[model samples]
Target: YAGPLLEEEALNKAAEKGLSSPEFLELCVWLGSQIKSLCNMEESITSTDGGKDVESFQLEVSSFLREMACPYSSLISGDIKDRLREKEDCLKLLLFLSTELQALKILNSKKMKGSHLEKHNEVYQEVQTICDALGLSNSSASDILPLLTNVEQKIKDILSKVQNNHVGKSLLTKPLNSEQVERLGKINDALRSEYECRRRMLVKRLDVTVQSFGWSDRAKVKTDDIARIYQPKRYALSPKSTVTLAHLLAAREDLSKIIRTSSGSTRENTACAINKV
Candidate 1:
């Protein structure tokens, strides 16, 4: 019976012993799902010669879950308590993944020139919103903000898959357990710290590069300014979402080419900005 084909005799024997054992209730819930797979769902409840008693078994398991939810009546509504009976731990994890995927979509929409900082802000807000609403520990906004992604298409794919799994309206997503929440928090923290360290080094490199291109004090762009100008958007926003700078840059209009002819100083500043990256 454990394999694909269930022998009539073996199934009958299992039904007899299983119904009388301490694990009878658990067996009933499993049997319902198994019956759903089998061709004879109706016959399962009707006593068959092999020894399966389907009707009483289904009733007993349904009552067991209902009784387990009884003590919390004062706090939880009847509808919610019933749903808790069927919900599994994995369902909550899927729900969290769905939320983050949505956040990624929001970040992807913000990809553009000079919008990296703003994108970081929004992604951070989304992450914090989930954490707060779900009673997850509040993480550092600045540190988490940089984790956002701008990859729209990839996240769209993932979100689509997750949504497909969220079929029913009934399976309640329990608040992420403490361990799961903390693990995600630590991941965000570690990633943000790593990104911050990388940005610092890049800024230093940018400073050196800018100084070498000096025309005048105003002509030399700061590394931080360069990052604002050319550092990849995904790298810029962290702990919030992921998006690459190149992808957004390609989609942006080439406005620099349209700027009118200017005086020497103006030309130099504009040239520096355009050529640094």
Candidate 2:
């Protein structure tokens, strides 16, 4: 029932064809089983059609991504691979969003239960811990982190509503209200400080992560540096004798100078003999 609603109608068409075409029966059976499994789940399954209700939506979206991951695995080539990667990215985003939302829900629930609003710092710290454990990747964190600001605003709005209700009604005398106002101011200050610190930390990590795109190039250059250029010498060394081309050139120059300096008949005869040779 939910499968047809959640999945496209073509799934049902395929199931009908499965009765006549044996080739499609396998897919039909698998899809039917998947739907049956979902139906068999206890009523605890949230009926959040596309996650409209905050709690119900989160639960439903989480379950939806897990199920979508199945057909995503069947993708073998072309754009499907990209789509699969996108789905994976979406999964991570959902995970982060759901984790944070769930945490905020818990915190708000506790606050609503009269546990004391002073413990918001502890609650924020716990949320930070959960974020770290998730080991978020660049591909997903960008898409997911933005939702945090929205959720944060929602939290602030809710908290403000709670405080407003408490402050209204003239429940406290002027002096007591003044003292409570001071405490509330301090709490807000502490929360602002924490949010600033967390934002800076996230920014620093994002900068490093962005720089990592070039890190592979840096690694390649470092590897290439290990290889020195092969320089070719003009002459080779003989056993126990290191003879460079400079030595041969110098010797030839000396011989040429000797021949040039000679000017007598003997030199002329010698030059004539050298030329003949």
Candidate 3:
């Protein structure tokens, strides 16, 4: 990481001229910039320290680190005042701080990448679900908008057909005599009653089914749930069936080997048969 290089440069400079040198001040400024950038603070650290005395500058830096809740703030602040003038001690503290800040930057980058990946996966899954509902192949991400458009067009077509059917029925009824209309009305009422009776019977059956499954009456039962309830338990494979399955698998491998090694015409015929199946 850049931490080691920065520390080495700072140490070399400090060894030549001591901790109170311009090199030390530059290191402090760099550290301040890093902290501010990482925390997204608008205030300039150098501007805040301009014209301040050594004690005031130290206090400001310590307070700023504390306020930002920076990692290792307590340890760094505690050492900063006592070790600011000691070249070796000051360099060590700076090295630790720089390493920690660099680590924090890496972690933040990874978190951002992970969050973006999760969002992309969620969107992809949602698109795939939509494609499945519309019975479309989700072959590529570029197909998403076209799939949605196709679904919208299908809905529009269905609604248009329903409207036209309703209009046609109305037109047909307009030419009917009053007696015929009254007879049709009676028949409609009888059919409605019959349907209502059947609906009630189905509802009761559904309630019984729900109770059998230990589900609440208000709980929704989807097609898959009903299928699950009715699905037969699979028995363990018998020795004979196991042997048959192994033979089939072996045959599949042999067929694959044959397809790979066979002449062009034979390979094409096998491929066509596979596609047809």
Candidate 4:
């Protein structure tokens, strides 16, 4: 199939829609894992286009096409690009989704032997059957799908052994998609932007306050030190910086006060508050 070039406008469109679809997220995660697998390998597997004797190249490609079909659309759409650049949360989500997808791949690898592993194995077999039936077993497709089921099942067993068993639960229950992840990226970006603006305003206020106290800009008055004076663990309490949060809170409070005070007075104390506080 012909793929579209990942144009800026297409990327913008994907970003605007936001990855709100759970299917999309799952698809992205799968693609990521497959790409990683394709990129990394033992030296022997790298030289030949993966085993040449097992099956006809066209047949192998066709078998892998089913798995490959979903992700290429997103790549062409540029959904992953914007989502990746958004924030830590998106990265975490992407990684989590990818882990689940890899788990699915592992599950598809091993043949059905145990009762618990039966369903997953069946799915893998079914996918292979479908590929054969659909005439998609071509050499042009990657070989990932034939083994995807077994790989994903094995990963499931490993995940079940984790201390935080919630990983499996979340993967099994969460219905997130590409559109949703894209939406999350937007939300994160908005928060980041707001936080940055407030942070900068607070920094400016702090600088003016220090200057008003007859301290030169060269005289370093670390915000952490200021917060520590108030409470020793103030900054340590949260994973992030309390001093930064405090500055933003104070800046907001000061703004509210100035707005109230400036309602009737033309010569407002806004400057004084910024400089003297």
Candidate 5:
């Protein structure tokens, strides 16, 4: 389907909505797993384009990347451009592990084997039924896991460069088609509605990345320190139970003055008060 060229306006307007969307966070967690899956593999494999589900999963991620990419702006440097392209390619490798692939993973699991659009077709049911009836005899096309590992770092780096960029048109670019913009726009809008849920999901998924990228060992994200990002800002004691050190010191000084002013009999009482403190 034709979409208007992704204009900067849409991305500038990119909503942080749905960060907690199960599907979106699930995808993010899936992405971290993809990185590790690629890293552990012996080689990279590719999937042949297949069912509608594959198309849907691919579109969800591709739309996100295209929205994040900046093909029209002069702002991104050559190294960054190449990195973005590599990131896009890495995401495609992740698709090889898609749920559609998992369903076809077993020989007995039905997958649509033939097109209903063909001449003299026997499976005359709707495409959905057609999809439901076919089964895999043995395999998925190829595993691209190893190839994905090679570019994971590159993609992460590109994200670092672009994550904070959402200010002016000249500084960013989308230049995407109508369908992509529209679909992603809705996602951004949905985010504003259920942000708490999304944030929780986002954190859970991002936490997985720490293990995948070995961030746990160093308390960092690539070159950047992430100890601050993952940590919640909380005091060990309650505000009502605590006083500033300065205030405590000043109060102690006043107590000392009271002890100095006390007569011999009252001095004993003041000493007890100081001892209690």
Candidate 6:
């Protein structure tokens, strides 16, 4: 008997003191409306007359249950109004109706989900048909965007090359005289010297700025030397080296000593003992 239509406190109160005639009628009307909407019925079987009495409410509830093809529709009859006056009977009826309504809502949701899946399938089939008409491979659908992007990029590149060639031809149509060529060479030399001077000035300024920030190549080299001095070194075994019986006997003694020393000692102490050995 728990749902959006009924609150826990209200249901508890109804269980203690059976649902009032007006409250019962109101629930029945709400149930009828929900059933009609879920079933896609054009018209409601329950009456909406404001002056309806207890017997009319019961009859409407029975009709709604029957219309929904409820298995327990027989439980709701003309005498249901009297039975609902008792707290136990009212709770039983409420539970039954709530269960039926919840089932209907679940069924309707599943039906809507199935319809949505069908629509998605139809769209996929339409896309597949269009791809077939275009003579595209079945796998092309997955990579169509990448293929189109590649083609567009290639077209842009071809256009750029054509534009560059046209500009080159236009320039070549007008030849330079020997005097003009000599003047151009002199100007090029002057620009190159100016560029070199500016580049040197920029490098000097960068060096000064770095020194002001206390950063120097000498300091970096010193730090690297200190790190190398403190770092542990690992030696690799030579491929041509062979282990003799003495080496094996020494290893077995080291293992026995390590096991005895580590039994009750902390990891750091055990490591120190192993190092000493």
TM-score of each: 0.20, 0.16, 0.40, 0.22, 0.15, 0.43
Candidate 3: lDDT of 227?
A: 51
Which residues of candidate 5, in runs, are more than 4 Å off? 1-52, 70-277
When sorted by TM-score, best at the front, the candidate numbers are 6, 3, 4, 1, 2, 5
Superposed by TM-score, candidate 2 places the C-alpha of residue 89 at a distance from the truth, in angstroms, of 85
Better of 2 and 5 by lDDT: 2
Residue-level lDDT of model 2, residues 123-198, one tens digit each, is 5554555455544222333333554555566556656767555423432223435676677666666766676677
- Which has the greatest TM-score? 6
Measured on C-alpha atoms, candidate 3 has an lDDT of 0.57
Error of 1 at 198 (Å): 0.5
Over the stretch 207-246, how does candidate 4's per-residue lDDT look in tens digits?
5664465444543555446544634533333322233322
Q: For candidate 4, give the lDDT of residue 271.
A: 51
For residues 1-277, could you state the per-residue lDDT of candidate 3 as single tens digits? 2343356565677644533565565666677777667766644446334566666666655565556554654434566556355556555546655775787699889999999888877766766776678676556654456667776776576667675444222213135567976776676667666766776676667657655764545444464676565443211211121122223223432233434437887766666554667
Best-to-worst order by lDDT is 3, 6, 1, 4, 2, 5
Per-residue accuracy of model 5 over 19-136 as CA lDDT, tens digit each: 2223333444354344334334332222323532433443444443343342433223333323223433333333433433353344222223333234213222222232333321
lDDT of 6 at 122: 69
Residue 74 in model 3: lDDT: 43
- TM-score quality measure for candidate 1: 0.20
| TM-score attained by model 4 | 0.22
RMSD of each: 22.8, 33.0, 24.3, 26.6, 31.3, 31.3
Question: Highest lDDT, which number?
Answer: 3
Please provide, for model 6 over 104-200, each residue's C-alpha lDDT reduced to its tens digit, 9 standing for 90 to 100.
8999899999998888676666556655555545654443455445545655665676755442222123456789667766766676667667766
Q: Model 2 off-target regions past 4 Å?
A: 1-176, 218-277
